[model samples]
Target chain A: MTTSSIASPDVDAEHEQNKTPVSFLGPFCTYSHQATLLAFPDTSKWVLEPTSTIKEVFDRVQSGAAPYGVVPFENSTHGVVTFTLDGLADRAGEYPDICVCGEIYLDVHHFLLGRRPPSSSPESEQRSSGRGGEENPKGVPLASLSHIRRVYSHPQAFGQTARFQAKYLQPLGIEFIDVSSTSRAAQLAAADPKGESAAIASELAGREAGLDVLARWVEDREDNTTRFFVIRRKETTEGGYPPPEEEGKRYKSLVSFTVPHRQPGALANVLDCFRRRELNLTSINSLPSLVAPFQYLFFVEFEGGREDDHEGRISGVLEDLEKVAERWRWLGSWRRKR
Target chain B: MTTSSIASPDVDAEHEQNKTPVSFLGPFCTYSHQATLLAFPDTSKWVLEPTSTIKEVFDRVQSGAAPYGVVPFENSTHGVVTFTLDGLADRAGEYPDICVCGEIYLDVHHFLLGRRPPSSSPESEQRSSGRGGEENPKGVPLASLSHIRRVYSHPQAFGQTARFQAKYLQPLGIEFIDVSSTSRAAQLAAADPKGESAAIASELAGREAGLDVLARWVEDREDNTTRFFVIRRKETTEGGYPPPEEEGKRYKSLVSFTVPHRQPGALANVLDCFRRRELNLTSINSLPSLVAPFQYLFFVEFEGGREDDHEGRISGVLEDLEKVAERWRWLGSWRRKR
Candidate 1:
């Protein structure tokens, strides 16, 4: 994490009063928690609150029950989390108070875990078993995969670790069981004293749940990472916005809008606004509008802070969009995650 | 399905001589099948082959074993299918032979299914149960909710029917099980032959699997739909390029490319290429680059047939992009689904 100088005294005071509790999607120890820790490292400063579902995390933040909520927005391999995006769009009209204020990226590492005796530690067993010795090399067989009858994981995890599953589990006729979240899967695996069931979850989750690591880095891709967003109630002029940016810190603004289908170059016209100002875009995604068939709602992220209007160029683009877009929402602006 | 006139007699003759079979992702029946049927309605003319996975469907098409392969591209409720997108990108360098040539859109309707006999059918039972009392006036109790123990469906199906699940299944303490597909779930429920388990699938799947429809239109959104693609090997000029367009059919072309990170507005400049030619975009999505962290590979869809340019305007844009883009692939040009 990069150390930064404080920007405002009032922002510090407000954070102090409400920073004790923060909510995230979890049974416990999920990627959301990993991202929260990445952004707000000091456990002593903030109380970690775990919600049962992603929607609940958003609800807590919208209701002001938690000062901030952390939710997974996108994964490198899986693409965007539609559940979170849907939550953002579907409830926007109803919960106009909530806005995204920060972002964090967490590199994910999946581990295959199973219940085992504490005496046979994963590290010692791996050391004794030897490294790179063919099939059984990297670690002890840990009760051959042939004995494992069931596999538990979040649906996305199953896809990420497809190669591993095909190599080891498929021939054995293992059954995959989908749970609500990875942490929950870990919890379930730990609860089973027998080694018949295994789970694909984070190393932290496996450790916390007292499950032995059967395999490390099982995901197909090495650089598996998930991006998360910190959502909070909108900070109006009365409370001021996110602490003034530290010198040299870059920022990103998120906005969503709909284009009329009848217009010939409506979508292009929107992109032109960003181009004219040389405001580089980070990402752009479109979701089909529920009310209108074939119509879409575009979610866009662009470089530059909300305050980076040297000549009101950024503001000018926003104003231009407001005029032409069928429906528009200035989601929020915050420091871009390094 | 629209009646399309034969554009090329030579192409038709070639298809007639070689069209032994077409492939789709399946375990007998899936949305892919629905799409395949929509695009190729005359089943007797071409044999229908089912592959175990989406990759196999593409593999079959690329290997020339199948004339055409149908796979899902995106869904209105759930964003793009990343697995399919990744497959398209990862194989371009290796294959460079396959190209999408057609498209289809199918409106999805999820039905609740159970194994109750026709006499104790869901429609008759729900009517007498008075669970909601307002919707069903036919008035005959089927099986009680207490008898239902588990619910099964694809993970996305769970989200689509969240409201129905909450109101009916959740209050009854029903267990949710995730299957590979909705059709597979229906098959499982039908195999049970008991009312203890239920599945959320399509009415077609339920009827084919001998399961009773427990409820109709259980999804939260009424306009749920999925878009699919028809893939075939590319035809070079020497090898025969795509056939000339018919008189009235419009087309959409797909292109993907990576931009240099150091450039200020590299991405915007690419979009400008389209804007300048007045070429309208249908969709745009960015996926993170695996090799270069934070860098992105953009998948863009736009209107205009492959041979639309009288002055080669579209080709000019493609050539200009090849000069500036780090990597580019003209994935395909297909008849746009209407």
Candidate 2:
């Protein structure tokens, strides 16, 4: 069996000993890992603890195994990271102790990483040169794909790089295999002795997994970015990242709620309230309530943070929502990141 | 490489001769296949044509390769089927020639299908007896899981059967593998020589793949149903299914739209129009517009068909939406299935 990058323990011994542990979805070098690294750059103050799943990231933080959790929230092209939503939603009756204390917008750039063919030379690399998008080009010209019969990557990566696949890979009739993570995809491709496979993953993932960069800037869009939530216990002040200097002090909040179904006012009762209050909602999404067939739970993220509700405007909106809606949940209110 | 069920032509010879062909997301026994089978039960009138992907389903219908297409729209537990949404949305300035003609609500019940061990007997099957959710039980007791080291199924099945996984599979340390379709998953499990893997798929899929019933009613929720849309050329009148009798004469329509961003009235204006009209919206979902980061396209399905808009109330709503919204696309106005 090809070894998984996640299967091997990659946490630093020094972090295990002296560093304050922070949780993220890991086996190292995933986008989540990259976000965790960026959000907590001071290694002396914090050690990165990577969990196998997003649920585990929430679990580790909730259980106090780690002080902070970083999980993918959304991608510009692909949209929501579903597991993170599942972890946060529908917690109405409980204490709802975990929250979105912060967010990270990581610019996503997927690379085609593959195992280098034995005796492969520079001329072959020139073939792959003209196909990539115009982005920050690195030092050397990259190699093009050769005999990449199969590709391994997270499904999200495939969604984000549709143009790349249609232009470069689909014509080749290559098989796309969905794995759990991009890092795992990179590691699996790296371990293939036949060199018949390549992975679409982050450059960091490729480097950590010992895969060669077959192509750079392989994603379909130039502005591919993913929003990640930096979460921890709602009441905990033990660990925190200072707000990035580039971000203004404006704040944002997310709340999940339910409205009576199959009626005009079922949802309008809530959305109009926001309009009436002038509470600018950033995004709104709905999922099945699970109690009944057509019932829905709505997750709404808005501009004003609960901490920054100086005029009690946000509270007034919620007060109206609580009365008009069947149920509501406060997920988090954190400093907004543009 | 294993041959895909989708690759083999499953269309009946007689179908090629006289019957109307309807496209479905297929490898011959997916939930979409089941929906297609239910909606087009009159073999003399219609023959089921299965496509490799949701896009292919849309393509076939649009290109008249098939007179109609059956694609999954949403799940009671899993929310929206994104690929289907992507196929329907963001079509402006171009004629959205393909439209949803009808809908199918299939009661989804997952079964653990696998190869029965060569030496197995009735008593060994007894151990799996009490684990499944109570439902309409069949004749003899089903076979129990034996060395089910891996499970093959669609990611949606994994989501719907989370309780079953947590209670039964997780404790056994079984690895969950995601495949393109549940029928493909069953085909893979049935093909495994060692009989160490099982699939979570429909009983129809199991029968098609020649896998045994390892467990029935494996889905976590009793109300695990999926909604599918019957799509065809917008102006085509050559073929259509008679709406199921129980659904009465009620109708539903879905329109995807975008409002200006970073302001309250941006979305609230459009929703308030629906509010003023008392239009009962069934569901609302948002996805990234892909033209820009954080910008969104909203898909809203509400009661009242455009065909039934005698008062022009529906037209009035759309008129206001067109005025306030940046862009919108009329996906379909189909007879709603309860």
Report the Cα lDDT for residue B118, model 2. 67
For model 1, what is the error of residue B111's alpha carbon versus the real structure, in angstroms, after optimal superposition? 1.3
lDDT of 2 by residue, A147-199 (tens): 78899888788877766776688778887877778988988898888988999
- Supply the DockQ value of model 1: 0.27
What TM-score would every model get versus the actual structure?
0.79, 0.88
Error at A62, model 1, angstroms: 2.4
Q: Poorest 10 consecutive residues of model 2 chain A by lDDT?
A: A1-10
Residue B228 displacement in candidate 2 (angstroms): 0.9
**Candidate 1 C-alpha lDDT tens digits along A1-338:** 22121111234556566546678876557777777767656544666677766777877877878878888988777677777887777533556777788888888878788854445645545411214234433323344566677888987787677678767877788877777788878888877767678889877777677776678778867778888998888873322223454334678888888887746567767777787777787877777766566567888788886766677877888888987788788888888866
TM-score, structure 2 vs. true: 0.88
Best candidate (score: DockQ) = 2
lDDT of 2 at A118: 62
User: Candidates' lDDT values, in order?
Assistant: 0.71, 0.77
